[model samples]
Target: MAWDTEATKQKLLNAAIDEFAERGFAGARIQEIAKKSGCNRERIYFYFDNKIGLFEAALVQQLVTALDDVPVRGTGPEAVADFAGRYFDFSTTRTALARLTVWEGLERGYPVGAEQRALRSTGKVAEIQNALPSATMREAEDLLLTIVTLCNAWVSTPNIHLVLTGAPDLQRRRASIVRTSELLAQDTV
Candidate 1:
């Protein structure tokens, strides 16, 4: 039988994402990932070299997917609001990405995927800058960061989110982001 390396790698990634999201790097087990993936343990080393490598691959892949899946639409304050709304929806609905990010922060002693991540960040900021022509790169980055952080906060720390917001309604939080984005956009517009 011919080996399907890509399929095997994808299986490993799918398993590792759940494991890393649930357990973090320090707590994630290679056996669990292998068992969940139904792939040989050797495949991990062959495909990724080590557990850290798998985590990095899974994290990067998921981040890319999330970014690709959610896009900001339109221009000006309306566009900013749309972008924030889309992000809020993405973070709330497809929650593994946010949890994985939190896990990465806790487990990774040094930065992971810095070069690739910087590129992605640059593109997203540029998209925002384009949508709001009057906004500078710094302003766009700050706005993007703020929107992402605000959107993810609920899923990252539900208890605190509930305590502050008085409820766990994501719609309410999303509305807040849209309003905030519109206000920020107004500054540029």
Candidate 2:
């Protein structure tokens, strides 16, 4: 596979993702990541400066992969609903991302490399704003954040999806997102 040539680097990234997900930034360790990745400690520094750099890189990679999976193209209420559904599904599938991101922001502060992260996220927000021409940028950002926060909360809370009523968990989650989007649009109107 393409990742084989960069096996060590990819291992380090994957290890960092798990470590950061489990332990957050302050608690995550280079030794543990190296051990998990089956590589020497020097390899991390050689590839990514330090633990901070590695964590940031892994987080960035997660966002990039998410964007690839859910590209910003369609617009309107249905488009917004589609984005919300896609995002919720992505977050649920990639459970580690919410844990890592939440833990890092809560325990370790988000100043490090936030600009890059925001830049990548901004495209989606802008597209949403464009879709809803009547909605201001701030309003679009707020609505988008609310949908993300709700999905993150649902995923973070244990067995919340089970409490949810539907034939399948995805159906339940999608219903919740669509309902929330409808509320947001109504409030805007």
Candidate 3:
């Protein structure tokens, strides 16, 4: 029987994501990941080179999937609202990915793959810019940043949100974010 290297690699990646999201990079254990994936510890090194490599790959993959799942389309407030709602849905539902992001910032100080990450961000910025035709590139980027931050904060800091709002309601928070994004988009036009 032939081993499916890709399938094995995916299982490892999935395990690593859970481990890293829970413990952060510094705290995550390779042996635990191995045990969780039912793979040998040695294979992690073979595929990812090191713990850092696995962390970066896991994070990058999550971001790629999120972006693909919630792409920006069309022009103006309605489109921006659409993107914001979808992005919020992705971010909130996939809390692990957002947790991984927070973990990376705290442990790494600066993000890994600064240039590559910037390129991916550039794509999102462009999408926002295209939707808000009257806005400059910088404005679009800032707006995108604002929408992301607003959406992520509620989920990432549920306790704080509950304290401030008296409830942690996904539907309400999502509606607020979408309304804000729509207004921002309308202001540009």
Q: Each candidate: what lDDT?
A: 0.86, 0.77, 0.87
> Residues 1-189, candidate 1, lDDT per residue (tens digit)?
999889999999999999998899999999999999999989999999998889889888877887777776778889988988988888888778888888888779665777787788788888888899989988999998888888877778889976776867767778888999889888877
lDDT of 2 by residue, 1-189 (tens): 354538788998999999988888888989999999999999999889988889888888876677567754565676677777878888888877777768767876754567877886687678777767777878878877887787677656656555664334666667888778856855654
Give the Cα error of residue 5 in candidate 2, in Å.
7.3
The TM-score of predicted model 1 comes to 0.95
The number of the candidate with the highest TM-score is: 1
* Model 1 regions more than 4 Å off: none
Clashing pairs in 2: none
**Decoy 3 TM-score against native:** 0.94
Summing lDDT over every window of 10 consecutive residues in candidate 1, give the lowest-scoring window: 161-170
> Can you write out model 3's per-residue Cα lDDT over 1-189, one digit (the tens) per residue?
999999989999999999998999999999999999999999999999999999988888877777667879988889999999998988877877788888888999978756666788889989888888788998888888888788777766779977788967789889999999998888788
Where does model 3 exceed 4 Å of error? none
